[model samples]
Target: MTFTLAIVGRPNVGKSTLFNRLVGKRLALVDDQPGVTRDLREGEARLGPLRFTVIDTAGLEEATDESLQGRMRKLTERAVEMADACLFLIDARAGVLPTDEVFADILRRKNAHVILAANKSEGRAAEAGLIEAWGLGLGEPLALSAEHGEGMAELAAVLTPIAEEMAERAARVAAEAPETDVSVSDEDDDEAVRKPTRARPLQVAVVGRPNAGKSTLINKLIGEERLLTGPEAGITRDSISLAFDWGDVPTRIFDTAGMRKKAKVQEKLEKLSVADGLRAVKFAEVVIVLLDAAIPFEQQDLRIADLAEREGRAVVVAVNKWDAERHKQEKLSELREAFERLLPQLRGAPLVTISAKTGKGLDRLHAAVMRAHETWNARVSTARLNRWLEGMVSAHPPPAPGGRRIRLRYMTQVKTRPPGFVVMCSHPDKLPESYSRYLINGLRDDFDMPGTPIRLHMRSQAEKNPYKDKKNWGAPSRLRKHLDKPKPKKG
Candidate 1:
């Protein structure tokens, strides 16, 4: 691993701007708003010849209790502990606030290697604040203009030495390490390392209507207030991904902004946030369509679930705030009925109940997600598919058009990952939608595919031509008959 640097500061002090500058991309959402970044976002930072891993953390607030800002502070402190060095940025324009001083003392107590930097130091207007930053007792502040691309060379100059030292240490460790071989074949071991099974973290996105506690659920699952949450709706604007293990299963969960109905989402920012949430759903293999236990399935919720189904993502419907429900059994049953009736496409998919605030029923949700992923990627041998197809056709024959049934001649699995199938037939188009649904249901039941989208493609046999194999196309019928008769004369 490269040397890790953590940029810590109070809210809106250009921490994210510097992060974006170092990473050479606008990864962290930046605005004039304070505390825009409430989670620790890491990026591979490259400046000049120096390269290292940099973490942009939430603003170091003075809240040391169970409040939101306190939790945010705790997250930032955790970053400080994990990183090799800390870049303590103070807004030179608004230099050296009490919170910054308090945060500085905390860093000192933690014994973290600290690099003092004063951001927004562009002109004489900031000179007084920049000078004041020197008294923060960390070191001579590296004057920085993160937004305007100024003081970057000086900042790089300071970090280059540390980067070089880290590289040397890493090289030495690698050189000293002994080479060993596993008992298993290299290819098999490699496959075990990188495949979707358990090796790689499962990408799961939690999406739902605004105020459905999606962010709260993710935060509860991670066991840290890693995301910003409030009583207000749509607290999360950006789709933030956090990595953690769920019951020994590595997982990456994205806490997305709650989606409102498109008609109601008139603000440009809301549209972007909703778009980002949609993107997270598409990027994810498994999406947890969260619903408020009290409100249950709204029209917007149905739309979101349908979108996930259309995207061919494995789905789990989670009713959040289950602890607040008065009649648990009845609510669960009601939720089930509604889920099936409203989102028929995701019927038989896991509909779990949980309180993201209290972290209930997460294990069941976890299991369901894993199962859905497996179902989504399920495959069947062509022989087995054909066998199943024969039984299905026998059970309910395709609709006969003009007193002739549209024969399903054969079936084969074209691919997996949402389980696509191809059926060769006499007349594919003659197969009705209801019949196709029947076949799909049969496939689902016979193959035990649950809560996963299934694809079916139909190909009709080529029409036969009477003269397709003829040798002499120009020959008249009389000449052809005469030629056949001459063959009898020769005999």
Candidate 2:
């Protein structure tokens, strides 16, 4: 098992800055404003020779009630419980506040290993705060500037022993575990051969409008309160990804910030958050467009699903909060009708009803996701595709433009994963967009690839004029001379 480290501190104490440095990427959004990070963000961190998983938690707050701040505090405390070690950070410039002292004491009682650090300790102004950090009494306070990359060597040195200790503990646990009998029949061996050598984690991103239960659904899927979820509309600011096993399938799921209309996204932080979520969608192989059942298939929801379709990603529409719905069958039928009418481009896509709070309909959601993925990656043999194309063209022949007949000669699938195809034809430029849509729809229906994006490209493959470059190519020499002589006599 890899060592786990949690960086916990008050807001704007440069916790995100240090996280970015250690991870060697600007993953977590950093701003001068406090509470820029509300959800817990995890990344693989590396410092010199040490490598481990590091979690950037929400800024520790003193709130104990059910408000947003209180919810954030509870999430951070959960991180402290799960981590192998905690790095208690304080702003050296501001010295130690009462909140810092209170959190430090809580860490001492809860966590066995705690390392205190005074950030922004690069200058003389932070000297007093560094001394104050030591008074917290967790341990010797390491003075470092997260932004300036100072004290990284000292931090790495301190973490080396902790890594070794974790490795030792893991070894002991492995040694004490029971071993299975090593017996393989011929059938077992053949079954093993049929299995894949390795399966990479599937990349899935859940996105929707604000207050659509995106975060809550993800938390339910992972079976943990990993993401900060409450009655708040925009509790998630960063697109946090969590790697876990979803019913025996390894998956990396992204919980993205709720996307709103472009005109309404006025704040700088919100803009960044939305952009981050968009990036996640681009990288994802499958996207689940979450919808609030009460106001399902709104303009924003349709736009989101269409965006996923345009990106050539597998899409599954999930109506969340179904447990609260009053009329189930009528709502389902209405939703289906609206889905087909408003978003015909994604016709035949899976529409599932789910309740993130009650964990109902998740199995169906999982099956739909897997089915969509399979369809997205489906490939058609070139011979089969050509046969189907011939039948389609025979059934509805190409239209003639300007009294000249257009020919459809050949067709083949060019790629998969949101399958692409190329058709060899006469006057590709003259092909109408409606005709192209006709072919795409045919492919989706005949090939059983419903709802996945299909790309069709027309290419003119007419052979070059064979005799254009040759001399005396038009007629025989004698015939050419006779024609020239006749012309002179007539004059």
Best by lDDT: 2
Model 2 TM-score, 2 decimals: 0.93
User: Tens digit of lDDT per residue, candidate 1, span 1-491?
Assistant: 47999999888999989999999987777777687777678788998877798999998887888776877788888889888888999988886788878878888877457889989999888899888887889888898999998988888888877777778888999899997644664456532443454446789999998889987888788887667677767667778778898877788888888898888999766777788788888899899999988788888989999999999888998888899999898878887887778887776898888878878898888888888988887878889888888888888778889887788888888877678999999878877888888888888887899779998989988778888898655589878766666454563
**Model 1 residue 66 lDDT score:** 73
In model 2, which regions exceed 4 Å deviation? Answer: 178-199, 476-491
Worst 10 residues of 2 by lDDT: 189-198
| Residue pairs with backbone overlap in model 1 | none
Query: In TM-score terms, which candidate is top?
Result: 2
Candidate 1 structure, TM-score to reference = 0.83
Give each prediction's root-mean-square deviation over alpha carbons. Answer: 4.9, 3.5
Off by over 4 Å in 1: 46-52, 61-71, 92-106, 120-132, 143-145, 148-154, 160-183, 187-199, 230-232, 402-405, 460-478, 481-491
Q: Per-residue lDDT of 261-343 in model 2, one digit per residue for the tens?
A: 99999999999999999999999989999999999888889899999999999999999999999999999999999999999
Q: For model 2, what is the error of residue 179's alpha carbon versus the real structure, in angstroms, after optimal superposition? A: 6.0
